[model samples]
Target chain A: MIKKRFILNFPPDSGDKPFSYHLVKDYDIRINILKAEVYPGKRGSLLLELQGKKDNIEKGVEYLNKQNIICESLDKRIHFKEEKCIDCGNCTAVCFAGSLTMNRDSWKLEFDKEKCVVCELCIPACPLHLFEIDFR
Target chain B: MQKTKTYEEINLKLKSGKAVILTAEEVAKMALECSPEDILEKVDVVTTATFGAMCSSGAIINFGHASPPIRMEKIRLNGVPCYEGLAAVDSYIGATACDPDNPSYGGAHVIQDLLEGKDVLLEAWGKGTDCYPRKHIRTKINISTINEFTLFNPRNAYQNYNVAVNSTKKMIHTYMGTLLPNLRNATYSTSGELSPLLNDPGFRTIGLGTRIFLGGTQGFVVWPGTQFNTSKPKNEYGIPVSNSATIAVMGNLKEMSPEYLQAAYYDKYGVSLFVGIGIPIPILDVEMARRVSVNNSQIETSVLDYGTEGTPKLGQVTYSELQSGTIKIGGQKIRTAPVSSLSKARKIAGELKKWLQNGDFEITKPVQMFPKNTSLKSLKETEADND
Candidate 1:
């Protein structure tokens, strides 16, 4: 299965429509709404992770474009260079979103991609330069 | 106090490969199953460590003389300003010293870069004397090329400290990292139970001339740090409930590494140094082992509201409460964040333990004890003309 993240921008009027529900019902795609600020009569945004067959993901994007809801695919995400990481957990101190955390038992660093907000705060906090922004 | 183990006994055990070593945190955990006497009998030494932002820390470097030599006056390293008030070629780089033109990088960063073996741009303009003719020099130097590099920190390892939070609507950056305003978040720095000063509390085993593991090397406690408050109120443990004491530490900067000595910046809070320090608390007896086994729940500190101009102390809270990642203030649940990396603290403690077992490092008894009941007073102006 192919997965992609996107920043969905909605026109003020389109905020009233249900985009995610339709994407799942019509396109047979799995939707994970990472963040959503869409409100009725407001120009808002929705961050989503869409997963499905490659053809279905493309068709879903085509549908979003036809509705004038600008959907931009995101390429930026936090990537941990495990080899360089010493499991120091310095990155966890600044990761307000709980993206990086230490395993209590093993005392090793555990990274959760979905929880990361791409704040780049961890980039400078790490002494070994183990964290990077992966554009994929 | 129960028959405390002598310092010599502990050393002998370590030398003979029969000594049992444990980190402060481990001792705290063992406290549940083992009594103080049992622990004292089994453990010879308990290693303590802390990694946190220390603003009053810096290094004094004696770069030796250049060809012919010049009386160095103005000096800067890696764009960070350095104090040239020392002798001819000696320079003191302060932890809070930031890049002269840009505020992003600071002296702490420069020191870390030096430890990383990076070539730093050293620019100095000195007065040319008859004997020392050179006037100005711009050179790239690394830690290995320097003659003498000393980590002479005036204050470090605060016994206990305040948890920082903001009372205002806007966020404020501090040496403690970002404090979300309106009690939204709190930031704390100490390694809590694993900290050196916290484990020893009363300086029974730790004092002036005490050998320590500092920045990945053996170091010493030179003196009591600035702003030390030995008069603070103590709990049943004979330790203060808030920040009380600190140590002036000295170590060879050449033997340090970037892993333990890090450069950090807290956004608008400016530059501060993250010092890695480990103190081996000798299980001198049951009393010492019991002291070392103190847990975060037993240790407490104040939570200060930093958004206010006065930075008033909000209330007293235990490290256990802070470590749980949240605390209630004014009936609202506030998220807590750690400024010090306990993971790094644990790493330092483990490293120090290996050094001791492998016979690479040894502990030293204090030549002189730290001052007890000492008072810190501010300078006052005298009335001369009126009198």
Candidate 2:
């Protein structure tokens, strides 16, 4: 059970209520609105918990981008280095889920679009800091 | 079977232009969601001591670096960079060989040791002086007889050799007999004396003049008891019958029991009897090995007291001498002595020091190094190609 928390911010009275309403109705997500009485002179905050497939969650994030939520973020980030990588199959071999691969007759490494769970198991194998996860 | 897909087929978007930053918790969660295959598409390299797979040796492996990285990653999902030098060196070699972009550097800890004045064969033994008490006892018997004639006898003769001699002898041994006991008896006693006592063997034997020695036995007892309460009884009411406990407690009381007590002392003032257990030999060996390896030197045979019973004494051989194989311990030249000796050990130290210097030599070469900067354009082009 992987759980992630994200803080999404919106402009005050941007008329984005319809978008929020549509997301909750379509995606079956739970949302809580912060009451103005508890937090004086503050714009409303909506707490959301979305449970489903990772790809779907990503799609929801993309939807937020489409909805123009500027300060949208997940608790983690996936990082990679461009210069140090050699398309070696070592990381692929270590990855149990078959997340990494090497191009035939070439020194290029490849990652599966749908199969990656972002475990960062390959980060230590790459001594040049080619792979990393930023949870801050 | 799915034909082994080329790196390009995995993903084109992850060409190394952008950075992905995720917290440890987030990474773990993401890892759980995606399969290893899915992860391969986003990044060109993977690094960790533990690969999350069960079959692997669990040692850290570095894929992209030419030389071992200064800092190695830990076997954890927390995303903290833990450093394990030896594992890092080995893993760097493993990863470089597989990756085309990075060139391999042959592993070189042994070479490093040579630079630090360590001999290869004798390198296993550490450098230090140790003294241990060695006791030996022997018993022998001789018999003589004299004959005298009385007044009634016509001829009197004094026969010393020809007369019959009746002799009865009894020997009572102490340490090796009652206190230490022979190999079989020792084992039987330590383990429960069951029908198949042979199956679970213990001590070898206790010889004559073998009193409880201080250094080896006492040192072993103190650390473990302090850390985990291994040999000590569960409570103050419980008494320790084993010799190991008695020796450790008494030794500490004489030498530095106060130091150990001060370190573990709690702020609350109260009169309480603390029962502690002593550390085991193997555990001490492992910790010593780790410490020695980190220090970039091997331990000497003398430190471990190869021949002596239970004390640390000055060793005859110096670190340089043992590397050349002049000193011998336990029938073999002291190649790598553990930390337990290094003091009071003599003949073994000389042989060990000589062997170490002879075997301590090394050389190094650069295989392949990482490129300076790989642009996103190149990465995209590489990913587009099937080959």
For candidate 1, list the clashing residue pairs, or say none: B4-B284, B4-B285, B5-B284, B5-B285
**DockQ for the candidates, in order:** 0.22, 0.01
lDDT of 1 at A114: 64
Q: Candidate 2's C-alpha lDDT? A: 0.25
lDDT of 1 at B48: 91
Give the Å shift of residue A23 in candidate 1. 4.5
Q: True interface contacts reproduced by each model, as a fraction? A: 0.10, 0.00
| Per-model TM-score on C-alpha atoms | 0.86, 0.19
lDDT by residue (tens digit), candidate 2, B189-288:
1110000101101111111111111211221111111111123221121211121211112232222121111101101111111111111111012221
Quality class of the docking in candidate 2, CAPRI style:
incorrect
lDDT of 1 by residue, B46-106 (tens): 8999888788899998877889788888898977889989878999999889875677688
Deviation of model 2 at B265, angstroms: 41
Taking the candidates one at a time, how many backbone clashes does each contain?
4, 110
Q: How far does residue A97 in candidate 2 sit from its true spot (Å)?
A: 3.8
In the range A9-106, model 2's lDDT, one tens digit per residue, is 55455443576565566654444432111123334333344555566566666787677654233333445664534232334433444456544223
